[model samples]
Target: MKYALKRIFMLVLTMVIVSFLTFLAFELISGDPAEAMLGTEATPERLAALREELGLNRPFLVRYASWLAGFVSGDLGVSLRYRQPVWDLIAPKLEITLCLCLASFVLITAVSIPLAIWSYRWTGTVFEAVRTAFNQLCMAVPPFFTGILMTYLFGIVLRLFVPGDFPDLHTRFGEAMVHLFFAAVCLGIPRTAMTVRMMRSTVISEMQKAYVRTAISRGNDRHAVLTRHVLKNSLTSAITFLGQTMAELIGGSVVVEQVFGIPGLGRLLVYSISTRDYPVVQTVVVILAFWVVLAGTLADLINQQVDPRLRLGGAA
Candidate 1:
Protein backbone atom coordinates (compact mmCIF):
# COMPACT_ATOMS: atom_id res chain seq x y z
CA MET A 1 0.00 0.00 0.00
CA LYS A 2 2.72 2.43 0.96
CA TYR A 3 4.76 1.61 -2.11
CA ALA A 4 1.77 2.09 -4.39
CA LEU A 5 0.95 5.36 -2.65
CA LYS A 6 4.51 6.54 -3.11
CA ARG A 7 4.35 5.74 -6.80
CA ILE A 8 1.00 7.53 -7.16
CA PHE A 9 2.38 10.63 -5.43
CA MET A 10 5.44 10.60 -7.66
CA LEU A 11 3.21 10.22 -10.71
CA VAL A 12 1.20 13.29 -9.75
CA LEU A 13 4.35 15.28 -8.95
CA THR A 14 5.87 14.26 -12.28
CA MET A 15 2.73 15.40 -14.09
CA VAL A 16 2.77 18.77 -12.31
CA ILE A 17 6.40 19.29 -13.27
CA VAL A 18 5.71 18.19 -16.82
CA SER A 19 2.73 20.55 -17.12
CA PHE A 20 4.77 23.45 -15.73
CA LEU A 21 7.73 22.85 -17.99
CA THR A 22 5.44 22.47 -20.99
CA PHE A 23 3.83 25.82 -20.25
CA LEU A 24 7.17 27.47 -19.46
CA ALA A 25 8.84 26.24 -22.64
CA PHE A 26 6.06 27.66 -24.78
CA GLU A 27 6.32 30.93 -22.89
CA LEU A 28 10.02 30.95 -23.76
CA ILE A 29 9.47 30.30 -27.48
CA SER A 30 10.52 33.23 -29.72
CA GLY A 31 7.35 34.06 -31.67
CA ASP A 32 4.35 35.91 -30.36
CA PRO A 33 1.27 33.69 -30.58
CA ALA A 34 -1.01 36.71 -30.64
CA GLU A 35 1.01 38.20 -33.48
CA ALA A 36 0.87 34.94 -35.31
CA MET A 37 -2.86 34.87 -34.78
CA LEU A 38 -3.34 38.39 -36.05
CA GLY A 39 -0.66 38.08 -38.79
CA THR A 40 -0.43 41.09 -41.20
CA GLU A 41 -2.92 43.00 -39.09
CA ALA A 42 -0.85 42.69 -35.91
CA THR A 43 -0.10 46.31 -35.26
CA PRO A 44 1.16 47.31 -31.77
CA GLU A 45 -2.16 48.31 -30.27
CA ARG A 46 -4.05 45.41 -31.82
CA LEU A 47 -1.41 42.88 -30.70
CA ALA A 48 -1.48 44.27 -27.15
CA ALA A 49 -5.25 44.10 -27.02
CA LEU A 50 -5.28 40.53 -28.34
CA ARG A 51 -2.60 39.46 -25.87
CA GLU A 52 -4.57 40.96 -23.01
CA GLU A 53 -7.70 39.21 -24.19
CA LEU A 54 -5.85 35.89 -24.36
CA GLY A 55 -4.25 36.66 -20.98
CA LEU A 56 -0.83 36.49 -22.57
CA ASN A 57 -0.05 39.95 -21.17
CA ARG A 58 -0.46 38.70 -17.61
CA PRO A 59 2.56 37.83 -15.45
CA PHE A 60 3.99 34.42 -16.33
CA LEU A 61 3.35 32.84 -12.92
CA VAL A 62 -0.19 34.15 -12.79
CA ARG A 63 -1.01 32.82 -16.23
CA TYR A 64 0.52 29.45 -15.48
CA ALA A 65 -1.43 29.22 -12.24
CA SER A 66 -4.65 30.02 -14.03
CA TRP A 67 -3.97 27.52 -16.80
CA LEU A 68 -3.02 24.83 -14.33
CA ALA A 69 -6.15 25.41 -12.30
CA GLY A 70 -8.31 25.22 -15.37
CA PHE A 71 -6.48 22.07 -16.50
CA VAL A 72 -7.13 20.35 -13.15
CA SER A 73 -10.79 21.23 -13.47
CA GLY A 74 -11.01 19.60 -16.94
CA ASP A 75 -11.17 22.87 -18.87
CA LEU A 76 -8.19 22.56 -21.23
CA GLY A 77 -8.98 25.90 -22.85
CA VAL A 78 -9.63 26.46 -26.56
CA SER A 79 -7.67 25.88 -29.71
CA LEU A 80 -6.63 29.07 -31.46
CA ARG A 81 -6.48 27.30 -34.79
CA TYR A 82 -9.64 25.21 -34.60
CA ARG A 83 -11.61 27.82 -32.71
CA GLN A 84 -13.17 24.96 -30.72
CA PRO A 85 -12.82 23.60 -27.21
CA VAL A 86 -9.40 21.97 -26.94
CA TRP A 87 -11.02 18.95 -25.32
CA ASP A 88 -13.48 18.56 -28.16
CA LEU A 89 -10.69 18.59 -30.71
CA ILE A 90 -8.35 16.40 -28.66
CA ALA A 91 -10.94 13.87 -27.56
CA PRO A 92 -11.46 12.48 -31.05
CA LYS A 93 -7.81 12.74 -32.06
CA LEU A 94 -6.72 11.08 -28.83
CA GLU A 95 -8.80 7.99 -29.60
CA ILE A 96 -6.90 7.48 -32.81
CA THR A 97 -3.47 7.90 -31.20
CA LEU A 98 -4.33 5.61 -28.32
CA CYS A 99 -5.65 2.94 -30.64
CA LEU A 100 -2.54 3.15 -32.80
CA CYS A 101 -0.21 2.97 -29.82
CA LEU A 102 -2.15 0.13 -28.28
CA ALA A 103 -2.17 -1.89 -31.47
CA SER A 104 1.57 -1.33 -31.93
CA PHE A 105 2.29 -2.31 -28.34
CA VAL A 106 0.27 -5.48 -28.74
CA LEU A 107 2.14 -6.41 -31.90
CA ILE A 108 5.49 -5.74 -30.25
CA THR A 109 4.77 -7.77 -27.12
CA ALA A 110 3.13 -10.63 -28.99
CA VAL A 111 6.12 -11.10 -31.27
CA SER A 112 9.09 -10.08 -29.17
CA ILE A 113 8.59 -12.13 -26.01
CA PRO A 114 8.13 -15.45 -27.74
CA LEU A 115 10.93 -14.73 -30.18
CA ALA A 116 13.25 -13.98 -27.29
CA ILE A 117 12.46 -17.26 -25.55
CA TRP A 118 12.92 -19.18 -28.79
CA SER A 119 16.21 -17.47 -29.57
CA TYR A 120 17.50 -18.01 -26.05
CA ARG A 121 17.11 -21.77 -26.45
CA TRP A 122 18.98 -21.70 -29.75
CA THR A 123 21.87 -19.44 -28.80
CA GLY A 124 24.93 -19.89 -31.07
CA THR A 125 22.96 -22.06 -33.51
CA VAL A 126 22.55 -21.04 -37.17
CA PHE A 127 18.97 -19.96 -36.46
CA GLU A 128 20.05 -17.71 -33.61
CA ALA A 129 22.66 -16.05 -35.84
CA VAL A 130 20.09 -15.39 -38.53
CA ARG A 131 17.58 -14.08 -36.02
CA THR A 132 20.14 -11.72 -34.46
CA ALA A 133 21.21 -10.40 -37.83
CA PHE A 134 17.60 -9.83 -38.85
CA ASN A 135 16.86 -7.94 -35.65
CA GLN A 136 20.02 -5.85 -36.11
CA LEU A 137 18.96 -4.91 -39.59
CA CYS A 138 15.50 -4.03 -38.38
CA MET A 139 16.98 -1.86 -35.60
CA ALA A 140 19.21 -0.10 -38.11
CA VAL A 141 16.16 0.82 -40.18
CA PRO A 142 14.42 4.00 -39.03
CA PRO A 143 10.70 4.07 -38.40
CA PHE A 144 10.07 6.49 -41.26
CA PHE A 145 12.04 4.34 -43.64
CA THR A 146 10.15 1.26 -42.58
CA GLY A 147 6.91 3.14 -42.86
CA ILE A 148 7.72 4.28 -46.38
CA LEU A 149 8.63 0.77 -47.42
CA MET A 150 5.48 -0.66 -45.91
CA THR A 151 3.40 2.01 -47.57
CA TYR A 152 4.91 1.27 -50.95
CA LEU A 153 4.73 -2.50 -50.73
CA PHE A 154 1.41 -2.84 -48.98
CA GLY A 155 -0.47 0.34 -49.67
CA ILE A 156 0.68 1.10 -53.19
CA VAL A 157 1.58 -2.24 -54.73
CA LEU A 158 -0.56 -4.83 -53.01
CA ARG A 159 -3.41 -2.46 -52.19
CA LEU A 160 -3.75 -4.20 -48.84
CA PHE A 161 -4.97 -0.96 -47.26
CA VAL A 162 -5.31 2.62 -48.43
CA PRO A 163 -2.61 5.02 -47.29
CA GLY A 164 -5.00 7.72 -46.10
CA ASP A 165 -7.89 5.51 -45.11
CA PHE A 166 -7.62 6.10 -41.39
CA PRO A 167 -11.26 5.86 -40.51
CA ASP A 168 -12.76 7.40 -37.43
CA LEU A 169 -12.52 4.66 -34.79
CA HIS A 170 -15.55 5.99 -32.99
CA THR A 171 -17.85 5.35 -35.95
CA ARG A 172 -16.04 2.51 -37.67
CA PHE A 173 -14.01 0.53 -35.18
CA GLY A 174 -13.68 -2.54 -37.40
CA GLU A 175 -12.68 -0.73 -40.56
CA ALA A 176 -10.47 1.63 -38.58
CA MET A 177 -8.50 -1.25 -37.09
CA VAL A 178 -7.80 -2.62 -40.54
CA HIS A 179 -5.92 0.52 -41.50
CA LEU A 180 -4.42 1.01 -38.04
CA PHE A 181 -2.98 -2.52 -38.09
CA PHE A 182 -0.75 -1.65 -41.01
CA ALA A 183 0.42 1.60 -39.46
CA ALA A 184 0.99 -0.19 -36.17
CA VAL A 185 3.13 -2.75 -37.90
CA CYS A 186 5.33 -0.04 -39.31
CA LEU A 187 5.63 1.59 -35.89
CA GLY A 188 6.09 -1.66 -33.94
CA ILE A 189 8.68 -3.51 -36.04
CA PRO A 190 11.79 -1.55 -35.06
CA ARG A 191 10.73 -1.45 -31.42
CA THR A 192 10.05 -5.18 -31.53
CA ALA A 193 13.66 -5.68 -32.60
CA MET A 194 15.00 -3.86 -29.56
CA THR A 195 12.68 -5.70 -27.22
CA VAL A 196 13.46 -9.16 -28.64
CA ARG A 197 17.18 -8.57 -28.43
CA MET A 198 16.92 -7.36 -24.84
CA MET A 199 14.76 -10.32 -23.83
CA ARG A 200 17.09 -12.89 -25.40
CA SER A 201 20.21 -11.45 -23.79
CA THR A 202 18.59 -11.11 -20.40
CA VAL A 203 17.32 -14.68 -20.44
CA ILE A 204 20.72 -16.03 -21.46
CA SER A 205 22.38 -14.05 -18.69
CA GLU A 206 19.86 -15.19 -16.09
CA MET A 207 20.53 -18.83 -16.94
CA GLN A 208 24.09 -18.41 -15.66
CA LYS A 209 23.04 -17.07 -12.26
CA ALA A 210 23.76 -18.86 -8.96
CA TYR A 211 20.08 -19.43 -8.30
CA VAL A 212 19.65 -21.27 -11.55
CA ARG A 213 22.61 -23.49 -10.80
CA THR A 214 21.20 -24.18 -7.35
CA ALA A 215 17.88 -25.19 -8.85
CA ILE A 216 19.60 -27.48 -11.29
CA SER A 217 21.60 -29.08 -8.48
CA ARG A 218 18.26 -29.83 -6.74
CA GLY A 219 17.39 -32.10 -9.69
CA ASN A 220 15.02 -29.84 -11.54
CA ASP A 221 14.84 -30.62 -15.25
CA ARG A 222 16.82 -28.19 -17.37
CA HIS A 223 13.87 -27.37 -19.60
CA ALA A 224 11.61 -26.87 -16.63
CA VAL A 225 14.18 -24.68 -14.91
CA LEU A 226 14.66 -22.48 -17.94
CA THR A 227 10.98 -22.16 -18.62
CA ARG A 228 9.72 -21.70 -15.08
CA HIS A 229 12.60 -19.94 -13.37
CA VAL A 230 14.98 -18.39 -15.85
CA LEU A 231 12.50 -16.87 -18.26
CA LYS A 232 10.29 -15.50 -15.48
CA ASN A 233 13.21 -13.90 -13.68
CA SER A 234 14.66 -12.46 -16.87
CA LEU A 235 11.45 -10.80 -18.00
CA THR A 236 11.95 -8.16 -15.29
CA SER A 237 14.66 -6.48 -17.30
CA ALA A 238 12.69 -6.82 -20.52
CA ILE A 239 9.59 -5.31 -18.94
CA THR A 240 11.63 -2.37 -17.71
CA PHE A 241 13.25 -2.07 -21.11
CA LEU A 242 9.91 -2.10 -22.89
CA GLY A 243 8.53 0.45 -20.44
CA GLN A 244 11.42 2.81 -21.19
CA THR A 245 10.82 2.26 -24.87
CA MET A 246 7.20 3.39 -24.60
CA ALA A 247 8.35 6.94 -25.26
CA GLU A 248 10.09 5.84 -28.43
CA LEU A 249 6.98 3.95 -29.47
CA ILE A 250 4.96 7.13 -29.13
CA GLY A 251 7.60 9.23 -30.88
CA GLY A 252 8.00 6.74 -33.70
CA SER A 253 4.26 6.48 -34.11
CA VAL A 254 4.30 10.17 -34.95
CA VAL A 255 6.36 9.58 -38.06
CA VAL A 256 4.44 6.45 -38.95
CA GLU A 257 1.19 8.34 -38.51
CA GLN A 258 2.38 10.89 -41.05
CA VAL A 259 3.49 8.29 -43.56
CA PHE A 260 0.21 6.42 -43.21
CA GLY A 261 -1.85 9.63 -43.00
CA ILE A 262 -3.39 8.65 -39.70
CA PRO A 263 -5.13 11.47 -37.88
CA GLY A 264 -3.43 10.69 -34.57
CA LEU A 265 -2.07 12.91 -31.85
CA GLY A 266 1.26 13.12 -33.66
CA ARG A 267 -0.30 14.47 -36.82
CA LEU A 268 -2.43 16.85 -34.79
CA LEU A 269 0.64 17.97 -32.89
CA VAL A 270 2.54 18.67 -36.09
CA TYR A 271 -0.37 20.65 -37.50
CA SER A 272 -0.84 22.48 -34.23
CA ILE A 273 2.84 23.34 -33.99
CA SER A 274 2.97 24.56 -37.57
CA THR A 275 -0.13 26.71 -37.11
CA ARG A 276 1.16 28.22 -33.83
CA ASP A 277 -1.71 26.52 -32.01
CA TYR A 278 0.00 26.40 -28.63
CA PRO A 279 -2.91 24.98 -26.64
CA VAL A 280 -3.31 21.87 -28.78
CA VAL A 281 0.40 21.20 -28.95
CA GLN A 282 0.87 21.62 -25.20
CA THR A 283 -2.10 19.39 -24.39
CA VAL A 284 -0.85 16.60 -26.63
CA VAL A 285 2.64 16.79 -25.20
CA VAL A 286 1.40 16.75 -21.62
CA ILE A 287 -0.83 13.74 -22.33
CA LEU A 288 2.10 11.87 -23.86
CA ALA A 289 4.27 12.67 -20.84
CA PHE A 290 1.58 11.24 -18.60
CA TRP A 291 1.64 7.95 -20.55
CA VAL A 292 5.41 7.73 -20.26
CA VAL A 293 5.25 8.28 -16.50
CA LEU A 294 2.44 5.77 -16.11
CA ALA A 295 4.34 3.15 -18.08
CA GLY A 296 7.35 3.59 -15.80
CA THR A 297 5.17 3.30 -12.71
CA LEU A 298 3.50 0.11 -13.94
CA ALA A 299 6.87 -1.38 -14.83
CA ASP A 300 8.15 -0.66 -11.32
CA LEU A 301 5.15 -2.27 -9.71
CA ILE A 302 5.43 -5.34 -11.91
CA ASN A 303 9.14 -5.60 -11.20
CA GLN A 304 8.46 -5.53 -7.49
CA GLN A 305 6.01 -8.38 -7.87
CA VAL A 306 8.31 -10.37 -10.14
CA ASP A 307 11.32 -10.16 -7.83
CA PRO A 308 10.77 -10.43 -4.12
CA ARG A 309 13.96 -8.49 -3.50
CA LEU A 310 12.32 -5.42 -5.01
CA ARG A 311 9.25 -5.62 -2.78
CA LEU A 312 9.17 -3.33 0.24
CA GLY A 313 10.00 -5.29 3.45
CA GLY A 314 10.73 -8.41 1.45
CA ALA A 315 13.98 -10.32 1.03
CA ALA A 316 16.92 -8.09 0.19
Candidate 2:
Protein backbone atom coordinates (compact mmCIF):
# COMPACT_ATOMS: atom_id res chain seq x y z
CA MET A 1 0.00 0.00 0.00
CA LYS A 2 2.75 2.40 0.93
CA TYR A 3 4.70 1.64 -2.21
CA ALA A 4 1.65 2.07 -4.42
CA LEU A 5 0.83 5.39 -2.76
CA LYS A 6 4.39 6.57 -3.23
CA ARG A 7 4.27 5.55 -6.87
CA ILE A 8 1.01 7.37 -7.44
CA PHE A 9 2.40 10.51 -5.84
CA MET A 10 5.46 10.31 -8.05
CA LEU A 11 3.26 9.84 -11.10
CA VAL A 12 1.36 13.02 -10.35
CA LEU A 13 4.56 14.95 -9.67
CA THR A 14 6.12 13.67 -12.87
CA MET A 15 3.07 14.76 -14.87
CA VAL A 16 3.28 18.23 -13.31
CA ILE A 17 6.92 18.52 -14.33
CA VAL A 18 6.21 17.22 -17.84
CA SER A 19 3.33 19.61 -18.35
CA PHE A 20 5.45 22.56 -17.21
CA LEU A 21 8.31 21.62 -19.50
CA THR A 22 5.96 21.16 -22.43
CA PHE A 23 4.41 24.55 -21.82
CA LEU A 24 7.79 26.23 -21.41
CA ALA A 25 9.28 24.64 -24.50
CA PHE A 26 6.46 25.89 -26.71
CA GLU A 27 6.67 29.30 -25.10
CA LEU A 28 10.37 29.41 -25.99
CA ILE A 29 9.73 28.36 -29.59
CA SER A 30 10.44 31.00 -32.28
CA GLY A 31 7.08 31.72 -33.85
CA ASP A 32 4.39 33.87 -32.31
CA PRO A 33 1.18 31.82 -32.05
CA ALA A 34 -0.85 34.93 -32.67
CA GLU A 35 0.98 35.68 -35.89
CA ALA A 36 0.83 32.07 -36.93
CA MET A 37 -2.90 32.13 -36.53
CA LEU A 38 -3.53 35.53 -38.06
CA GLY A 39 -0.86 35.39 -40.80
CA THR A 40 1.59 38.08 -42.05
CA GLU A 41 -0.93 40.69 -43.18
CA ALA A 42 -2.52 41.12 -39.73
CA THR A 43 -1.90 44.45 -37.96
CA PRO A 44 -0.09 44.79 -34.62
CA GLU A 45 -3.34 45.73 -32.91
CA ARG A 46 -4.99 42.55 -34.14
CA LEU A 47 -2.05 40.47 -32.92
CA ALA A 48 -2.21 42.09 -29.50
CA ALA A 49 -5.92 41.49 -29.21
CA LEU A 50 -5.50 37.89 -30.32
CA ARG A 51 -2.76 37.34 -27.76
CA GLU A 52 -4.96 38.76 -25.04
CA GLU A 53 -7.90 36.62 -26.14
CA LEU A 54 -5.74 33.48 -26.07
CA GLY A 55 -4.32 34.53 -22.71
CA LEU A 56 -0.85 34.51 -24.27
CA ASN A 57 -0.33 38.02 -22.92
CA ARG A 58 -0.15 36.82 -19.35
CA PRO A 59 3.02 35.99 -17.37
CA PHE A 60 4.46 32.57 -18.21
CA LEU A 61 3.93 31.18 -14.72
CA VAL A 62 0.36 32.46 -14.60
CA ARG A 63 -0.49 30.90 -17.95
CA TYR A 64 1.12 27.66 -16.93
CA ALA A 65 -0.89 27.58 -13.71
CA SER A 66 -4.11 28.24 -15.56
CA TRP A 67 -3.39 25.58 -18.15
CA LEU A 68 -2.57 23.04 -15.47
CA ALA A 69 -5.75 23.87 -13.58
CA GLY A 70 -7.82 23.50 -16.73
CA PHE A 71 -6.14 20.18 -17.49
CA VAL A 72 -6.99 18.82 -14.08
CA SER A 73 -10.55 20.09 -14.28
CA GLY A 74 -11.05 18.49 -17.74
CA ASP A 75 -11.02 21.79 -19.62
CA LEU A 76 -8.14 21.42 -22.06
CA GLY A 77 -8.74 24.79 -23.73
CA VAL A 78 -9.51 25.57 -27.37
CA SER A 79 -7.30 24.83 -30.34
CA LEU A 80 -6.26 28.02 -32.10
CA ARG A 81 -6.05 26.18 -35.42
CA TYR A 82 -9.25 24.16 -35.31
CA ARG A 83 -11.20 26.76 -33.37
CA GLN A 84 -12.66 23.88 -31.33
CA PRO A 85 -12.22 22.74 -27.75
CA VAL A 86 -8.87 20.98 -27.49
CA TRP A 87 -10.34 17.83 -25.96
CA ASP A 88 -13.01 17.66 -28.63
CA LEU A 89 -10.35 17.89 -31.33
CA ILE A 90 -8.33 15.22 -29.59
CA ALA A 91 -10.99 12.70 -28.61
CA PRO A 92 -11.60 10.89 -31.93
CA LYS A 93 -7.96 10.95 -32.87
CA LEU A 94 -7.10 9.58 -29.46
CA GLU A 95 -9.37 6.60 -30.10
CA ILE A 96 -7.68 5.85 -33.41
CA THR A 97 -4.21 6.03 -31.86
CA LEU A 98 -5.32 3.87 -28.96
CA CYS A 99 -6.66 1.32 -31.38
CA LEU A 100 -3.43 1.31 -33.33
CA CYS A 101 -1.36 0.96 -30.17
CA LEU A 102 -3.57 -1.79 -28.83
CA ALA A 103 -3.35 -3.70 -32.08
CA SER A 104 0.41 -3.36 -32.17
CA PHE A 105 0.72 -4.53 -28.58
CA VAL A 106 -1.43 -7.54 -29.21
CA LEU A 107 0.66 -8.42 -32.23
CA ILE A 108 3.89 -8.05 -30.26
CA THR A 109 2.72 -10.29 -27.45
CA ALA A 110 1.19 -12.88 -29.70
CA VAL A 111 4.22 -13.23 -31.90
CA SER A 112 7.13 -12.77 -29.46
CA ILE A 113 6.34 -15.29 -26.76
CA PRO A 114 5.72 -18.29 -29.00
CA LEU A 115 8.78 -17.60 -31.09
CA ALA A 116 10.90 -17.12 -27.97
CA ILE A 117 9.77 -20.46 -26.61
CA TRP A 118 10.36 -22.19 -29.92
CA SER A 119 13.86 -20.80 -30.26
CA TYR A 120 14.70 -21.67 -26.67
CA ARG A 121 13.43 -25.23 -27.04
CA TRP A 122 15.46 -25.80 -30.22
CA THR A 123 18.68 -24.20 -29.04
CA GLY A 124 21.30 -25.37 -31.56
CA THR A 125 19.38 -26.41 -34.65
CA VAL A 126 18.93 -25.06 -38.19
CA PHE A 127 15.64 -23.53 -37.07
CA GLU A 128 17.38 -21.59 -34.30
CA ALA A 129 19.91 -20.22 -36.79
CA VAL A 130 17.15 -19.05 -39.10
CA ARG A 131 15.23 -17.55 -36.19
CA THR A 132 18.35 -15.70 -35.02
CA ALA A 133 18.93 -14.27 -38.47
CA PHE A 134 15.29 -13.23 -38.70
CA ASN A 135 15.53 -11.49 -35.34
CA GLN A 136 18.59 -9.60 -36.48
CA LEU A 137 16.88 -8.49 -39.66
CA CYS A 138 13.77 -7.32 -37.87
CA MET A 139 15.75 -5.49 -35.20
CA ALA A 140 17.99 -3.87 -37.78
CA VAL A 141 15.11 -2.34 -39.73
CA PRO A 142 13.30 0.59 -38.16
CA PRO A 143 9.50 0.45 -37.92
CA PHE A 144 8.99 3.39 -40.24
CA PHE A 145 11.03 1.67 -42.91
CA THR A 146 9.14 -1.53 -42.28
CA GLY A 147 5.95 0.45 -42.67
CA ILE A 148 7.13 1.70 -46.05
CA LEU A 149 7.98 -1.82 -47.12
CA MET A 150 4.60 -3.07 -46.00
CA THR A 151 2.95 -0.31 -47.92
CA TYR A 152 4.79 -1.31 -51.05
CA LEU A 153 4.27 -5.03 -50.68
CA PHE A 154 0.73 -5.20 -49.38
CA GLY A 155 -0.72 -1.88 -50.37
CA ILE A 156 0.72 -1.62 -53.87
CA VAL A 157 1.92 -5.01 -55.11
CA LEU A 158 -0.67 -7.30 -53.64
CA ARG A 159 -3.51 -4.79 -53.81
CA LEU A 160 -4.50 -5.63 -50.22
CA PHE A 161 -5.30 -2.05 -49.40
CA VAL A 162 -4.55 1.29 -50.98
CA PRO A 163 -1.82 3.36 -49.41
CA GLY A 164 -3.00 6.50 -47.61
CA ASP A 165 -6.63 5.56 -48.05
CA PHE A 166 -7.57 4.88 -44.48
CA PRO A 167 -11.26 4.32 -43.85
CA ASP A 168 -13.40 6.56 -41.72
CA LEU A 169 -12.86 5.11 -38.29
CA HIS A 170 -16.19 6.32 -36.96
CA THR A 171 -18.32 4.97 -39.78
CA ARG A 172 -16.35 1.98 -40.99
CA PHE A 173 -15.01 0.68 -37.74
CA GLY A 174 -14.31 -2.87 -38.92
CA GLU A 175 -12.56 -1.82 -42.11
CA ALA A 176 -10.61 0.78 -40.19
CA MET A 177 -9.41 -1.96 -37.86
CA VAL A 178 -8.27 -4.05 -40.82
CA HIS A 179 -6.21 -1.12 -42.08
CA LEU A 180 -4.79 -0.55 -38.59
CA PHE A 181 -3.89 -4.22 -38.37
CA PHE A 182 -1.57 -3.86 -41.30
CA ALA A 183 0.06 -0.78 -39.77
CA ALA A 184 0.24 -2.57 -36.46
CA VAL A 185 2.15 -5.38 -38.11
CA CYS A 186 4.69 -2.84 -39.29
CA LEU A 187 4.95 -1.23 -35.84
CA GLY A 188 5.12 -4.53 -34.00
CA ILE A 189 7.77 -6.43 -35.96
CA PRO A 190 10.85 -4.85 -34.46
CA ARG A 191 9.42 -4.85 -30.97
CA THR A 192 8.48 -8.50 -31.34
CA ALA A 193 12.02 -9.28 -32.41
CA MET A 194 13.40 -7.39 -29.42
CA THR A 195 11.11 -9.19 -26.96
CA VAL A 196 12.05 -12.55 -28.43
CA ARG A 197 15.73 -11.86 -27.93
CA MET A 198 15.21 -10.66 -24.38
CA MET A 199 13.00 -13.57 -23.42
CA ARG A 200 15.43 -16.06 -24.94
CA SER A 201 18.35 -14.50 -23.08
CA THR A 202 16.45 -14.49 -19.81
CA VAL A 203 15.46 -18.12 -20.22
CA ILE A 204 19.05 -19.08 -20.97
CA SER A 205 20.23 -17.19 -17.87
CA GLU A 206 17.62 -18.89 -15.71
CA MET A 207 18.64 -22.30 -17.08
CA GLN A 208 22.20 -21.65 -15.87
CA LYS A 209 21.14 -20.88 -12.30
CA ALA A 210 21.73 -23.23 -9.35
CA TYR A 211 18.08 -24.16 -8.85
CA VAL A 212 17.83 -25.63 -12.32
CA ARG A 213 20.80 -27.93 -11.67
CA THR A 214 19.35 -28.96 -8.33
CA ALA A 215 16.00 -29.75 -9.83
CA ILE A 216 17.65 -31.79 -12.59
CA SER A 217 19.79 -33.71 -10.06
CA ARG A 218 16.67 -34.56 -8.04
CA GLY A 219 15.22 -36.48 -10.99
CA ASN A 220 13.09 -33.78 -12.51
CA ASP A 221 13.11 -34.07 -16.30
CA ARG A 222 14.81 -31.18 -18.10
CA HIS A 223 11.62 -30.20 -19.91
CA ALA A 224 9.67 -30.33 -16.65
CA VAL A 225 12.23 -28.16 -14.91
CA LEU A 226 12.16 -25.72 -17.81
CA THR A 227 8.39 -25.44 -18.08
CA ARG A 228 7.70 -25.54 -14.35
CA HIS A 229 10.48 -23.30 -13.10
CA VAL A 230 12.71 -21.59 -15.64
CA LEU A 231 9.98 -20.23 -17.89
CA LYS A 232 8.02 -18.75 -15.00
CA ASN A 233 11.10 -17.04 -13.55
CA SER A 234 12.14 -15.72 -16.96
CA LEU A 235 8.77 -14.11 -17.57
CA THR A 236 9.35 -11.57 -14.80
CA SER A 237 11.98 -9.83 -16.87
CA ALA A 238 9.92 -10.23 -20.02
CA ILE A 239 6.98 -8.53 -18.33
CA THR A 240 9.10 -5.51 -17.45
CA PHE A 241 10.60 -5.40 -20.92
CA LEU A 242 7.17 -5.59 -22.54
CA GLY A 243 6.06 -2.66 -20.41
CA GLN A 244 8.94 -0.55 -21.65
CA THR A 245 8.14 -1.58 -25.21
CA MET A 246 4.54 -0.52 -24.73
CA ALA A 247 5.77 2.99 -23.98
CA GLU A 248 7.97 2.91 -27.07
CA LEU A 249 5.04 1.85 -29.23
CA ILE A 250 3.52 5.31 -28.80
CA GLY A 251 6.47 6.96 -30.51
CA GLY A 252 6.56 4.25 -33.13
CA SER A 253 2.86 4.70 -33.76
CA VAL A 254 3.51 8.31 -34.66
CA VAL A 255 5.74 7.31 -37.52
CA VAL A 256 3.50 4.45 -38.56
CA GLU A 257 0.49 6.75 -38.65
CA GLN A 258 2.32 9.09 -40.95
CA VAL A 259 3.30 6.33 -43.33
CA PHE A 260 -0.23 4.96 -43.40
CA GLY A 261 -1.83 8.42 -43.45
CA ILE A 262 -3.97 7.54 -40.47
CA PRO A 263 -5.70 10.46 -38.83
CA GLY A 264 -4.43 9.61 -35.37
CA LEU A 265 -2.90 11.74 -32.62
CA GLY A 266 0.47 11.56 -34.31
CA ARG A 267 -0.87 13.20 -37.46
CA LEU A 268 -2.73 15.75 -35.41
CA LEU A 269 0.37 16.50 -33.35
CA VAL A 270 2.47 17.11 -36.46
CA TYR A 271 -0.18 19.41 -37.91
CA SER A 272 -0.54 21.19 -34.58
CA ILE A 273 3.20 21.77 -34.31
CA SER A 274 3.44 23.07 -37.88
CA THR A 275 0.58 25.48 -37.26
CA ARG A 276 1.88 26.56 -33.82
CA ASP A 277 -1.22 25.24 -32.12
CA TYR A 278 0.21 25.46 -28.63
CA PRO A 279 -2.78 24.15 -26.73
CA VAL A 280 -3.17 21.05 -28.86
CA VAL A 281 0.55 20.36 -29.10
CA GLN A 282 1.13 20.84 -25.41
CA THR A 283 -1.78 18.62 -24.46
CA VAL A 284 -0.71 15.81 -26.82
CA VAL A 285 2.93 15.95 -25.67
CA VAL A 286 1.98 15.81 -22.01
CA ILE A 287 -0.39 12.94 -22.64
CA LEU A 288 2.35 10.97 -24.38
CA ALA A 289 4.72 11.66 -21.49
CA PHE A 290 2.08 10.53 -19.02
CA TRP A 291 1.64 7.23 -20.88
CA VAL A 292 5.37 6.61 -21.00
CA VAL A 293 5.75 7.24 -17.26
CA LEU A 294 2.64 5.28 -16.38
CA ALA A 295 3.85 2.28 -18.40
CA GLY A 296 7.13 2.21 -16.44
CA THR A 297 5.30 2.51 -13.12
CA LEU A 298 2.88 -0.25 -13.96
CA ALA A 299 5.70 -2.49 -15.10
CA ASP A 300 7.54 -1.92 -11.80
CA LEU A 301 4.42 -2.71 -9.81
CA ILE A 302 3.86 -5.93 -11.72
CA ASN A 303 7.47 -6.92 -11.18
CA GLN A 304 7.05 -6.34 -7.48
CA GLN A 305 4.15 -8.74 -7.47
CA VAL A 306 5.93 -11.33 -9.59
CA ASP A 307 9.35 -11.18 -7.91
CA PRO A 308 9.47 -11.04 -4.11
CA ARG A 309 12.86 -9.32 -4.11
CA LEU A 310 11.31 -6.21 -5.65
CA ARG A 311 8.73 -5.99 -2.88
CA LEU A 312 11.47 -6.49 -0.27
CA GLY A 313 13.51 -3.59 -1.67
CA GLY A 314 16.17 -5.85 -3.07
CA ALA A 315 17.68 -5.67 -6.57
CA ALA A 316 15.67 -7.22 -9.37
lDDT of each: 0.86, 0.89
Which digits, one per residue and each the tens of the lDDT, describe model 1 over residues 1-316?
5777788899999999999999999889837887888887668999898888888878999989999998888889888887798989998878888888888998998899988888887887899888888999989988788888888898899987788877778787887898888888888888899898888888878888999989999999978898889988988898888888776678778888899989888888898988989998888889989999999998888888888777764234
Q: Which whole-number lDDT from 0 to 100 does residue 247 have in model 1?
A: 60
Per lDDT, the best of the predicted structures is 2
How many backbone clashes are present in model 2?
0
What would the per-residue lDDT of candidate 2 be over residues 221-249, giving only the tens digit for each residue? Answer: 97799888888899888988999999999
lDDT of 2 at 209: 98
TM-score of each: 0.94, 0.93
Kindly give the stretch of ten consecutive residues in candidate 1 with the minimal lDDT sum: 307-316
